[model samples]
Target: MLTDTVEIDQFIRPAEIEAILDQAAAAPDSAIEAILDKAARFEGLSHLEVANLLKMDDRHLPRLYQVARSIKEAIYGNRIVMFAPLYVSDYCVNRCAYCAYNECHSFKRRQLTQDEVRDEIVEIVSMGHKRIALEAGEDDVNCPIDYILDCLRTIYQTQADLSGEIRRVNVNIAATTVENYSKLKEVGIGTYILFQETYHQPTYERFHLAGPKRDYWYHTTAFDRAMTAGIDDVGAGVLFGLHDPLFEALAMVIHNEHLERTYGVGFHTISVPRIRPAEGVDLSAVYPNIPDDETFKKIVAVLRLAVPYTGIIISTRETAAMRKDLLDCGVTQMSACSAVGVGGYMAEKRRRETGEIDPTLTAQFAKNDERTADEIIAWLMSEGLVPSWCTACYRSGRTGDRFMALAKSGQIKNVCHPNALMTLSEYLEDYASPEVKAVGYALVDRELEKVPKSQHREQARRNVEAIRSGKTRDLYL
Candidate 1:
């Protein structure tokens, strides 16, 4: 069903790429300010407008930032979707030059056993997270498709003996066969996420020097394969620092647009992961380095206005201040307390259980935001933003294309807001610390007043009690 192999090389013309870069490099402050103001009005930015914003200099960067922030607030509102990374394996086969866990790095690698993974789920559940993005390094033999399926099975099977549970588990692994994609669909994941580190074929070829991941066609066509396998919800992203951000952003938007055209489904989430420090990895040594803060913020804002419906994810790679600031500027999803090591949660649990600390597992990368899940929720509430644990969109058959339909029509908020409030209430009743719960309760009351009807308020109130009384409730009201 996938039309004439979807390749990044084919979709992004060299001339177009040069044009975006040229525009970025030569844009003036007046031009940049005009684009920002225009984008803030929700009329959406043209390719030229985005190029101009990227070209904006530091002297006028603050104005671009203001525009990005304004556009973000207008589209996404104050809801911040929270999830955590559940690292299933750190064993990789690709010899990518930038990654810390690439095969050539010789770092100690580990894969979690099913029991160990279950324990990790318990730890995350205890901390009040309801959505998890499962992460694993690409290794067919070490971390095969079956192994991922088992991990998903264990995650869905685990229960807290309480009301709230891990509602969604998004997958982030390397590209694989169509049969494997079908297996992933059978596993019932919320989103199948894969990043095409860079869209420039030559650079992509250079970074992915070895292993199956080197097959650029297979990697780029993963969304098509997943869709063919009945996995309608897939996420696409790129490592911004690997290539020119301007080129990558345009390619990314085009990639989504292509999917929409062919499969009637686009990426459920589009992530903008920048380069960060990792063991044995040096980002500065690489060409086309990380974008500065202003550039990064502008890229995200332009993406938001371009594809307003897709959930834009920014991860723990960003510092806390940067993350908090960026949330209002276009990012709708974020990770909390991520542990990119096998049995990391078990190691923590063992330390607590035995009253003795064990050696920490070798992490794949360093996480900047070390705040626990509880602390993050408290911060969001204090900022008057609702930290959501909702997976209603995924569960209620409103994902990928269906979700986009709601989002494009400006009706997504009707579902997103109510579900966010409901999920926040569940977190408060079941897992939050007393102080955190008190703050959450107050915030819920404030948020409920903004809900259109008294009926939803009553249903939300009842659901909170149901969750407290050990009765599970569906995400929909």
Candidate 2:
């Protein structure tokens, strides 16, 4: 068993973080441009260099964004991987002030049964999403490790009558023991995500009035135990509005660095989520650090430069305009048709059909981009972005350091790009409106030519033909 008494100071080191930010605030233009040049060469920046980029003037923000885009294209090409969130239970024992599902709220509590999970899975699969991020609030007794394991089993086995099924299930529940994580790994889970909420200990403690989450060290180091338990692919994040965005950003990078030094790999994915006011939660003490749109873009751009190989995620919390702009700034992953409450997908479908809102339904936080899967898919195709439903890496035994190596050496695109187009083909054939199908097929034709005429591309063509003919599905390199 890993002890919570491990030295947290060695990893986070707030004093050192402040000192680095202090020096970066005065960095000259020559130094900043040189750092940008290094980042453009695919040499990731240090924590101090990332901080300096954050302090750059608004006049130079355009160059920063340009370098970010160049690096993204260099690594992953013009594809955007898509997934959706599934909230199973909202019953909580934590008093997290920013969450609508915090225990202090007055709404009725709910936990989905295994049958209900199947219902949700059918809804998600029908929307043509192959990846699912399973979410739940922190309540051990009502939502224990056994219950979560059961939910995972149900999600994997459940198939939509529309001839669809979820291909990946990424679990994002609270911190737990290594034993529980091993159980999750046994069930073939992908990416164990738990956010640090706020790395500033005082703010974190103040906001989390009561609960197991109030333990600063334990929550901050969950990934350490996760990796030790052999869950190689893990995701990390901070609630950006909980503290100074720059500080949180630096700490997050440092945490990743620590993982690289301790284990052989770092965070496989990084999420950037901002706080929004919830319907029944208090936010009296959370103030002054909310990043404006321009500032948020800067954070994303610098993060892209600092962690050139890591996947950056921008959730549906951002507006459509902001999400569109962020695609150019460095966001590689996005959530479509997301619902942050228990059974939100099916409930939403009914609401759209009958114009009836369920009074009992509540969300963790409201989503900013509320478009359906087809609408968002059409918009992505119109913008020349290939909406990918690819889970090739997870299924092909290429994750953690192995995946990172392929990505860094520029060989990942050999398989990833082709897999992306084939999956897009799958979506069009399975569940797309006439308008969406027209847009998607044209994009696929244009994109297929961009794939160099290798066996990968040829196989992609054959697999796509197989999918369209309804002979074989779920094909990849």
Clashes of each: 0, 0
Worst 10 residues of 2 by lDDT: 1-10
What are the Cα lDDT values of the candidates? 0.79, 0.88
**Candidate 2: tens digits of C-alpha lDDT, residues 1-477:** 464455444588777888889888888999989999999999898888888988777777888989999999989888999999899899899998888887888988899999989988888988899998999999999999889899999988987854488889999999877778889999989999989998988889988999998888888888888887889999999998888899999999999988898888998999999887678754556467888888888999999999999999989998999999989999999999898889888798799899988889998887799888899999988888999989999999899999988888888988998899988988999899988888888888888888875677778888878888889788888
Where in model 1 is the C-alpha error above 4 Å?
3-9, 23-48, 56-67, 352-360, 468-475
C-alpha-based local distance difference test score of model 2? 0.88
Best by TM-score: 2
lDDT by residue for model 1 (1-477), tens: 554354443665657767776857787666767776676666666556656655667676566556656666655678999998888888888888877778988656788888888789988888878899899988889998899999999999998746546889999988876788888887788899999888888888988889889987788888888888788888889998887887888878778767877789777889988887787787666755688886788788678766666789988888999998778667889887776677777777677799766554667677788888888889988888999878887878888667777776777776677778888888888778999999998888788777666777677767666665666755565
> What is the lDDT for 329 in model 1?
69
Candidate 2 accuracy as TM-score: 0.97
Q: Score every model by TM-score.
A: 0.91, 0.97
